[model samples]
Target chain A: MTHTSSSGTVRKGGTAKRNGRGLTGLLLVSAPVALLGWLIIYPIFNAVARTLFTAGDEGLHFSLDTYQRFFTDGYALNNLWLTLWVTAVCAACLMAICLPLALYLRFAKSRVAAVVQGLALFPMFVPSVILAYALIRTIGPNGGVDLVLNAVGLPKINSPYLTPWGPVIGLVWDNIPLTTLMLVAGLGGVSDNAVEAARDAGARRFALLRYIILPQIGNAMLVVLSFTVLGIFSAFTLPYVLGPASPEMMGPFMQRTFSQLSDSRMAVTQAVITFAICACFGAFYVRSIAKNREARR
Target chain B: MTAHLSRRGLLRAAAASSITLAMPRIAFAADGFVNVYTGSDSNISDFWTNVILPGFHETHADAKVRVVDAGDGAGLRAIADRAMAALGTDNDPQVDLLEAFVPDETEGSIEAGLWVNFTEAGLAGLDMVNPAARQTDFDLPYRGSQVLLAYDATRVSAEEAPKTWDELTAWIHANPGQFIYNRPDKGGSGGNFVRRAIHEANGRDPRKFTLDNYSEAYAAETLPGAWDILKGLAPSLYEGGAYSSGNTQSIQLLSQGVVTMTPVWSDQVLQALSMGVLPETTGLVQLQDLALCGGFSRITVPTNARNLDVAMQLVTYVLSKEVQSKIITELGGFPGVSWDHVDPALRAKYADVIPATIPTFPAGDWDAAINDGWYRNVAPGIARS
Candidate 1:
């Protein structure tokens, strides 16, 4: 007890000074924070400013006409809603799929478990553009699935390509590796002894998961949900290739508006709106981190 | 995100330094050098490299010609913008020549003052050039292409194909799920298809709209009718109003037997056929009453080009009977000079696809507006179900 107390005392005060706790911490954080402000934050504010203010006959007049049009326009609204819907669906699906996979990877120590983890993480290596095209060839209409099915005497299948669900499938597939990684890292907190104790207390799979696993991994779940939302919301390539043409996702919509329509202001407005929504999703992760810090203190 | 950003930053820095390093190596030779800029595809570039360069080098042994392909006109646009910026200034524009782009005066605006006036310049081969193909004195029209209907002959007979816009609309209604066009913004075939539709709706007069006549009010009055025509045919498109995402996709759909007919560029379809990407049974036909839009690939010499004399000599050579025949035979395009000047065999071979007239479309503001408007109004008519 005396030895432990002395070691703890050494870690608390003397070590805290030697570690990057005060001026060193401030210096380290300031550089990145300042760079981020210059690169990211400044551009975001500038985009918002440009969208709201324009050069007209009156000279730098402020008008919400573009915003009004974006809000009122059915096409723009459809794109926004589609983006939102796809993000929500992708986030939910990621949680449902990844949570279980994470639990299995945590408990199952069999050699087969290593293979499963490798397969799940495979998408992390594949680029998103390649993944989209690979998905199209693998499951799209008149593609490999049809060829195999026809050989087996089955009816021609409806393809997900050029549909709203197309981006969702590609996104979920591309996202599995990261989501599973985060979730598995979260599952690390669920100690084997605790899980075993809960099970011996007559807690079945559901109860054990509900009480022990869920509580231990709440922060990880929050991180995954927030990240999935943020990642899927701003995704461009997959949706551009796989999604429908009309009610498309915001990423492609902004791009088409900027390059195709030759309207940079409109595109910037769409971008600002996209990031604004994503920033709200980011609040969840920030809050979870803060809560963990407070609990530690 | 940080890793991706840092890697991208490093790549951009490397690219900038490399481009700077290569900048000085561009031909600064006082004579016997001309850098030709082209926005054409690899096939056309290959023709320029293998056929045009070698032939020109044979005539002028000491001549050094470099053909640089600026993809999809972006590099051309940037060069033009740079030249325009350097106007009345001493900055070296560094560009020698542009192919497939024209520098001419817009009506009621300041004179372009960009290209050398070839008509007044009196090049040696001017007399042999076809009068009808010449767009303006600013441009030397060397080759031409048109948008035509590409159909699968396996399912569609030659007689069954429509020869006019109205007939085509009827054919689409009759053969539902067999016809599709790409999105107007994404592909030229779809853009030309929509262009012909606009012409058909507005009293069937291609002359009502001009390159200089576009205004907000004029478009407001003229575009609604066109939208109505496009929307009317929406339900009859492939997969119940589904539009292909691009020109290549539209052709891909036809090759996959998903659609029977699609609007395709003449040169692209010819190249694809030669490469055996498209089936042997694919047939092409141009509308008779009012053909879809096509343009002559005009070669322009910037008035301030470093190699103006050599460029003009090259132009005269390009306008020769020999090179014009190569334009038709080797390049799969129509000759700038009349069909009479080209080899009889090549002219006869292209009889079916030779356009009656190359109708032009307004490109500056009209293209973007038409594409955007289609997305807003006509695209919504496509039933997702």
Candidate 2:
């Protein structure tokens, strides 16, 4: 009976220690929660409220007029759609390029690897506007490309640098380095032991990669993918400097609507739309992580 | 322990209360700096602050002029839209004096109610501006330029230079591939040249077209004429007919000897000449007479200007003879106020690169030149031929 009582006492002591640790964790996390609430949640709430409810002659009214205007306005819808497609293309292209580089960096060990990695990141170091300007001069008609092309007997192609593709190319150029860096870090977390085990089980190289390597790093891979999506989605400066007047991407469209048309309400509405999409993508990303974790378990 | 707890609570409350009280003052003081939006280059902005604002400050000592460079002409309009939105509230505006394209004054500002009408501002010496400037009520014509042909004298001789439009067209055809100009819709200089061709085709007067009387059908006819010329000239142009987007690109084309000549603003040529981007032997020339040319940029006070008197004074000073001369000589702009004897130093400095000056076709004729079978009917036809 005395031994049983001692065991009960030990259990009680363990419960008390856990409760103390929980309290400390709560205090630590509260600071971040407060910061996020102030910077992100509060401003978003204010921007939405300012857009939806304008003080008018008839008193305050909640309305969907701004959203309606954004959709029905021919240019607005066109630009919004264009922004969506272009961003998707950019994100996809960046992922395509980065994933391979990341995988190679994870597996390979060569002096050239570091050099290639450094060069990939160089575009990100240059300011987006400056990069756009440099690209225009290098590839543009009056720029060096034309000078070289002329010598090669090619007709001077007017700067292909003006197309929507121009901005996309720039986006990919910049994002490749960063995305690759993040992805390389993520891929490194993948277990070599898993791949070796699968190969020992008589799996082929591709099958081992598909089954073992991908699963081990699925969580980290999701994180990289979400970041790639978000980075391409909200990119503004490169597109703003290099893009044509009528690109249908979200960043330039929102900027043009706000700065070109004096449409604050509409701009806010567009920003809301972007935030909503990002939030949705974020939710999906979280679901992906959870799904992968559950599958692994 | 009880005393310590109470003292700590008191100190926290005191700090919070002080911060709350100080917040509004900080916010208020942040709005004290006035924002001026200008579409001019960084060099121009520096000139304004360095040369012009100091003169104003000597008189009003307390006022400070803060100039924000907003790209070039198109960018100015975009910035105006942004600043207006930011300053939509009645409390304070984000911008005061606007240095923007003259077209936006008529096309956008009046409709948006963003501009301050200077009629009742009691601005002294307002009437002293030239008559051509006074015609456009919203436009305070600060400077102007003509779109003309820029050619490399080293590549093509004066004897080979086409003097008239017909001769130029024939020469371009015979040469089979030598002309270069940017897309007319994109570049002002190219658009000017296209319009000039339209005027020549229709034989229309230049000074009469206005909002009062505009004929879209006439423009439709005249514009296609220019397009046709472009189609024909396409083969002869630098590429199979692709074009650059702006003056800078066109100038680059000329510099590279890609095309013997391309349409350019006189100021652009002068700027390029000053920058040593263009060879010393390069020169610019206007079409003989009655070409489409009424280029000007304007500055106006926003409706929400806090210091109207000071802003008005700043505008007056910018348009003053001393300032205009400085801008013309040093900044590579043409003087808008009057064409007086230039400084000898300036004359010597710019002797090799003096732009040929030409009078705009009279305003009435200008209308006829643009609207009545000028740009639409004539330009496209010339391009095809």
Candidate 3:
């Protein structure tokens, strides 16, 4: 009876200790979870709810008219198309340019590589508005580029900086650093030994890259592409300052609809649409992270 | 038992200290201070900081004025949205006074009944204010501005400059990439130009468009001519027909000698001249046939304002001749009151650029509709090639 009582007492103590630990854990996580719910999740829920309902002559009723208007309005639809087109082009261009450069920086030990990497990263320090004005000064009429062309006895190249190409170039310049950094980190996961073995087994440079490097960094590429799309999709400053006024990017279009047009419902609908589109890429990002964690496990 | 009593005592002391700390802030809020929310445009905010507030402080030594710089358009909308959100709630609005361009800029809040009626408030300068400047009895006109064509006198002589809309078009065609105007939705000057163009193109009476209601059928019927006119001029605009984004950009292009002329606000031109953003050689003119749209800046007190009487007194002082003349002389803002009430010297100073007839802006909805239409019908027609 004494031995049995002693074991029973120890078991009770263990249960009480576990209860205390569980309470502490709950207290620690509850604050951040509550904060996230209040700040981010609550606002999103409110926006979506507001878009789905409307107050009319009778009372609050379910409606899809706002979303219908967003999809049907020619101007809004054109802007949506323009936003997608610009974002897709920018993402593809960024990957094409940054991937090779990132790979080179990953393997090359030369000082020139270091200098190139530093140069690629330099634009991250420059603010978008300042960078826009700088671009205007360089490519505007009779600007530095024109002066250079004039001195070299060549016809001045007409500036494409004020068109859709303007924002694309600016987006590419702004995103190179982050994309390269992510990609270079990703390339680190590719085993040097595997690359060497492939090369020794009669694999050429193209084949080695196709079989070894690209496959290893697929998750990283998805991550980089997803972020680039999100960044370009919601970008405001460069597009506003440099791009055509009509058929504007989603950011400026939403702003004008809300502030200039004073159509809050339409603005919210547009915002929800933008969020849904970005969420597609966001899903990929989340999946990549989950997969990465799974791979590590 | 002793430790328990001490802990309870400590808790009581902490609670008392917290209440004491919050009491002063509540008292300060009740101390009868006017909170003014104005646009962050340097022309508006700087004039208040450097002139109006200082002058008001001299007369009312005991009163305090706090100015908040809510940015233009988007910023003002944010403020209005916040104030509207607090409606029917227990919380009072944080703002007392709102400063904005009349009609179009303040329409959202006005429609929502966020502003108190100034006519019943017994404002001082109501009689002296220009009838054209009075949007309604509820709107108190504080300052005025008119859109005008600003040009580089060194590049184009006064005799060479276009004097009518038709002449201006011909001049643009002749000069190719030497003239520019911003997108209508971006700035009041550009919007004014677009409105004027629509009025001229349709051959409709400008007064008909000034009513508050917008008819979609009427706009659909009349907008094609305006679009056609805009399309024809696009190929001759600066940078191979791509218009600049905003008024400031057009001004920048002019300052850089990239363009010979562009539409700009008369008051902004004066401000830019003083700041050396525009050369002294820059000349201003109102087209003889087309009266450019002009309007007054409005000041309204919200219903939830803390110091309602003091806010009224502050606006009264702003409308007085001493302040009006100072605004005209320093900031180039036209008098909110009639010329008879303005100082004669100030009246003569801006005589050259002031229009004899000011064209009224279209209804708020029409203004937005026209801007949107420009983006839709007109912008796409511009030959990018």
Candidate 4:
């Protein structure tokens, strides 16, 4: 988020004097880079180091005991599997929901499109804790929905809160605005003239979408998927508050292991494993961005 | 001065990086003063500085006490270790008095005689304190809080409310979707409720479990039955076994009349009622068979305390009827002394919050095992997809 906003400012100031621009850019980049290395990279190395070595009867020796325990422990593996499943479902749901909204906001010339776009983006401003609390009150048992249903003579609604469905619903809802924005940006390349030409060539709506729109928006959708998967995989508050107790997402599972179980080593192991999985999506994102930059050049 | 400046500069850099550096509550710990280190939260620190210390000052005007906040008992343990190290050596531990200190926090503290024996000393007001509140001779308990069943009296009748763990389980089954407890790992209310379940499962005995009794094999044998008991009772809970996230949320559910019963702290419920956040009919009760767990704040002075005479004096003063009432009305905690020994008016006001007995569970290895097992076997009957 900081990167996007800072890059926007740099672009606005592009007409600055060309001489000493290298030094100027270096000065501008150094603070954030140094901060990231100190705050993020150092902690990552420390966590990984703690997991790779174990203090034993002999001495502080290199060992994989915690990683071994995590792999052999059915409970730990189940948590990992649940995290992956939630991330996958959230990614799928985000795309399925956001693509439609983005398309409507792009093509629909109605005045209501502005309202729809604003509604889609509103969740971005609401903090996740507030959003989760609102979701629980609105959908959980004997909550607002049940109150209304009872007043009108209907059965109580079966709540998704505390089920595996809970975090999925929350993550999907929370990620929609960003996903829509990204897909809409990608959709900018799908010109109306191109769609018109495709239609004039006797193409149906589905074919126009598949041939003209999807090809242009494919990279944006990938970016959205990669970011959503990474974010949802490591989310703590929503899963800790809303997800089921058993078979937890990795974020809550690692925290509970460290805090409740008082096993810091095991918690670090779980984190390293989670980081290894997220690295795949992260690598894909970086590579795609690099490839995009290369294509533009 | 240059070295001091560099140290302060480094500390500032670290403070700028981290969001919250727990600033010491009272900072002037000068030489020749009796240093008091307390391991309680800011509220109890305020209690010491405002209520207890001011009263002590009237008796000993010349003496000075400097208080330090040792967050969550770690500071007290660090002092105990320092005291242990200083025994028979020509070094000063520099720790004079401790509040909210647990003697068992450090290994060998008991055998090493690291603390002054409270019972053996026979302080002036020790006779007034409840015998049940005393855990060991090494520590003096001055304040306490218990988890009780917070219920809406309008929905659940006086006779209908549960008095025993078994009765509570039956009531939950009979009136499905009317009871709630927060997840065991989230709050003490639910954690103690789960501990009560474990006690019930293991032949209704609290003595079988001890601070040092936890083992993987023992937990595997004992906790499976507890998981079965909790899992069997889960379907009858509010919204088919959905637990509250914390003690406050559990009471929130009760306040909304969605749940008739939940475990809550005595102090919190009373405060909430006084604040008009909950209905007037909100009542608190304790389970009879084996009571829910509660935490007691105990003070332990080291055997080698420099101001041992003054420390003993302060203990007796804090235990007196006057301060004990302040414990109730001001601090919102139970008096370390019995109800009959405290101020009668304040006693009458807190009669509803008082329990016949408040048993506590240890929070170390056993706590971890029970909570982790609960998450694994009790909370989820649904298969992992």
Candidate 5:
């Protein structure tokens, strides 16, 4: 009877300890949740609420008016279209340039890979404004590029870097290194044994690349693509400094509207549209990752 | 099949997500000194901060002014809005005074109730200021500035340089891809260039710029001519369709021999010359009829000014000839008031840099064409090859 009573006491004590541990776990998670609510949740709520409700004089109301202006305004539409074209062109170009570099890094000797890898990332460390100024000095009209082009019997190059192309070059310069790094990490995950297996089966190199290698790194490509899209879409520094005053990009437009017009609502509206576009690209990324995981399984 | 189905399902699902980000406000709240928000250049800001402020403080020992370089007029408007909102009250008014460039921006500020009426406080002193400077009701006269042509001597001689709009266009046609200027909508000087070009083409009275007189219909009829002229010369621009979007870039282009000549602010050209950024051979000339002219800046005491008496004293000192001379001689801008009475030494030192006479708007009509988006309509013309 005493033994039974002692066992019951131990069981009750064990249950109490487990309950205490559960309470402590809840307390730990509460901190992050509170922080996120304060930092993330509060601002978004405020921005949306403020933009939606705020009204100004002279036919400027909080309703769909700002969005209306965005669609109808020739400047805004042209810029948006321009931004889309630039971002698309940049992504395709980055993929073309970075994929090869990433492949080479993956296949080359480790020492060579490390050196090239460091050089590739060198562009990333330089600020966009600094890089822009340097580019203008080098490739701008009468810049070094022109001098060299002339010396080589080539026609003197005009400052193509001044037009919309200037920002595009800077964006690519800043983004290619990062994309290359991400792609290298992705390509590295491809198993050598799998590559060898395909080779042993008499698969042509092209066929193996198209099938085995591509599928293995498909998720990584998606991730890199998404990052490139975001980088181009949200980039302000490069475009702000180097971009043509008539920047077609949403980033510069939003900045101009906020800074020049002092139109907060329109700035937020453009921000929303830009974020939406970037988010769609992000979704593609997430979907690719999920597909890769399923394929592996 | 199961994997494919799961993948398709995942793609079909749309989930919502939110992210929040905050940008830090720039420097705020200094002690002893009043925080001034101005759109003036760095050299002038330095002059105002170092010499003028201290000189003023000499009389009123307790008074100190801290100058915050708040960018251009449009940029200053944005700063004023942000600073005021962050302070959560206009009662304290984050900036004591705003020195702006564009009249429209100043008009916007007045509409926003950010400005105090100066018609009552300093009318007598302002009368002593040049008629050109006192004309703008929104601002006190700081100085009158204008765009001038700067040319590379190696590429183009003084005789080869176009003295007028028609001559310039002809010269550009004769020498294709040898001329450049900033995009009009982007740079202040570019706008001046376009406006000047239009006014010169029309040969119409420029002083009548109000919309009632300079109607949209009139703009539609005449602006196209200006656009056509600019577009005709566009092929002569560097890269055909690409032009530098700013004065610095245009000057840089001139330095590189990308273009033989470009339009720039007269003072900017002078400052660049002083800094040895441009070759000694570069020449500056004011265009005929002057398309753009700098206006006077004013210091108004906001109705809600914290230190009203102190603000008046500051304004009173800023308007004095001694302060104006310091502003002009050191800052490289013409004085808001006539420096006819300035000491011979001071005038002699500033003679080369300062214009003997600064131009002004004939009346309210000067910016009428711009109000109708005349500059912007013609801007793309200069961009087309």
Candidate 6:
């Protein structure tokens, strides 16, 4: 009977230890989970809720008026179209620029590659506002570019920095550091042995890039694409300072609705629309991450 | 309990007494300080800190002033949103005073009952305020600015500058890519220019449009002409009619000699002159027979202000002749008071630029409608051309 009591006590002690660990684990995670809900998730849910319902003469009521207004307005529709085009173009440009740069930095055994890599990442340190003003000074009419052109007896160029191209160029410049970094990390995951084997088997540069490197960095490209799309879609300062006033980007349009027009409901609705569009890319990002994790498992 | 206190209990009592003693100092610190949320630039803040605060402290020895830079119009809107959110809640509105540009910017907040009625509140300096400066019973105007054409004198002589709306259009046609104005939606100066053109296009009296009520019928009638006029000039604007995005951008274009002339705020031109953004030869001119939109910056005590009395005191101090003169001399802002009340020297200094007769902004809704119309009809039409 004493031996039975001792064994039972041991089991009880074990259960208590497990319970304690479970409680500790819950406590550890609960704070961060609650914080995340409070900061990010709650605000998003609130914005969506606010967009769905609006206050009226009677009280809170279900309304699609804000969304209706956003869609019906031709200028707002143009803004959305412009935003999507700019974001897509910027994403394509970023990939074209950063992908090759990343691969070169990874494979090349030279100081020039290192210096080029460092210079490519330099924009990360410059603030968007500073970069915008610097761009203005560098490429604005009769600016540095004009001065150089004039010195060489060429006609001064009208600033493309003030047009749609301005925001595209600015967004690409600002995003290169992040995209290059991600691609570099992704290129690291591509095995050098595989490349050597491909080369030995008479694979040309283009063929090696197409079959080996591209497939290896697919996940990284998706990540870069998702973030670049999202960033450019919601970009404010760069576009506001660089782009035109009318047919504005979504970021400035939503800002104008909220602040200048004092139409919070409409602004929230615009935000919801932007989120819905971005969610398509975000879903792809989630699936890619999950696939990456599953493949690792 | 005190009579029968143990050593621990006595020590606790002593510590509580010390804290109790320090409470008044903390309360005094809180009460003596007035928090002002202003959309004014660093120049205004510097003046407030160096001149206004010192002047106020001399009179009221215990008073302390804290100026919060709430940024430009967009920043002020964020503050307004916060203030609106905290309304009727248990939350203490940490803001006391709000500084805003007249008409459109401040109108929404006033309509929402955020600002206290100055007449009801019986604020000081009400009698001293100029009739022209008073936007409404509630809005207490502090400093004034008018929209005018700022030109690079080196590029265009004073005689060569356009004196009327028709002449301005003619000049633009004569000198394509030599003049620019920002999009009307972005800045008050640009908006004023657009409003003036709208008024001119319809051949209506400026005073009729400046009324307190906005008529949709009037706007609908006037806007077509306005769009036509804007489109007509589009071919001659900077870069074959691509406008700069904002007032400052237009100024930058003018200063860089990219464009010879642009509409800019009177005070901004002066400020830019001092900053060397514009050359010494830069000149400002008001259109002949066409009144530019002139309005004042207003100071209001918020309804839920923590320091209402102190805010009122500051407002009164700001409106004083000495302070107004300092505003003119130091900050290059026109006084809230009438010209006669201003110091002769300061008035003479700005006489050439400051128009004697300036048109007030139309009702808030009308101003907003004009901006929307410009963006929708004029901007797009310009783009197409």
DockQ of 6: 0.25
What are the runs in model 3 whose C-alpha is more than 4 Å off? Answer: A1-27, A53-63, A66-68, A108-118, A191-208, B1-33, B60-64, B81-90, B101-119, B202-204, B382-385
Candidate 1, pairs of clashing residues: none
Best by DockQ: 3
TM-score of each: 0.82, 0.69, 0.85, 0.77, 0.78, 0.87
Candidate no. 4 TM-score: 0.77
Taking the tens digit of each residue's C-alpha lDDT, what string does model 1 give over A1-297? 332235565456675554644566699699999999999999988999999999998799898888898999888998899898999899888888988998999999999999999999999999998887787677876778888999999987888877888899999999999999999998987789999998889999998998889988989999999988989999998987788778879998997887666578989999988988999988989999999899899
For model 6, the docking class works out as acceptable
Runs with alpha carbons beyond 4 Å of true place in candidate 6 = A1-26, A54-63, B1-33, B40-51, B54-62, B74-90, B101-124, B348-354, B382-385
Q: Positional deviation of B196 in candidate 5, in angstroms?
A: 1.1
| Candidate 2 TM-score, C-alpha based | 0.69
Task: Write model 5 residue lDDT over B1-385, tens digit each, in one string.
Answer: 6666666577555221111121123224434347677776665677677887888878999876677887665567565565344342644565566564333443345566555556665544666566645644646775556678888887677777777667877877888877777765456566667666666656634653442354558667766766666767677766664556566778887877667878887667777787888989997766554434444454544444555567667776777888777555555556777767455688787676565444333322334344224324543444421
* Clashing pairs for predicted structure model 4, backbone only: none
State the lDDT of candidate 3 residue by residue for B284-316, as single tens digits: 877778667777788877766767777888889
Highest TM-score: give the candidate number: 6
Off by over 4 Å in 1: A1-35, A293-297, B1-130, B137-140, B298-331, B336-345
Candidate 4: lDDT of B53? Answer: 89
List, in the given order, the native-contact fraction of each candidate: 0.32, 0.05, 0.51, 0.44, 0.34, 0.37
lDDT of 1 by residue, B76-123 (tens): 666666666655677666667788766632221126466788878887
The DockQ scores of all candidates, in the order shown, are 0.26, 0.13, 0.32, 0.23, 0.20, 0.25
- CA lDDT, every model vs. true structure: 0.82, 0.66, 0.82, 0.82, 0.68, 0.81
Looking at model 3, the pairs that clash are none
How far is B226's C-alpha from truth in model 6 (Å)? 1.8
Give the CAPRI rating of model 2.
Answer: incorrect
Clashes (N, CA, C under 3 Å) per candidate? 0, 41, 0, 0, 10, 0
TM-score ranking, best first = 6, 3, 1, 5, 4, 2
User: Is 3 or 4 the stronger prediction by DockQ?
Assistant: 3
TM-score-better candidate, 2 vs 5: 5
Worst 10 residues of 2 chain A by lDDT: A1-10
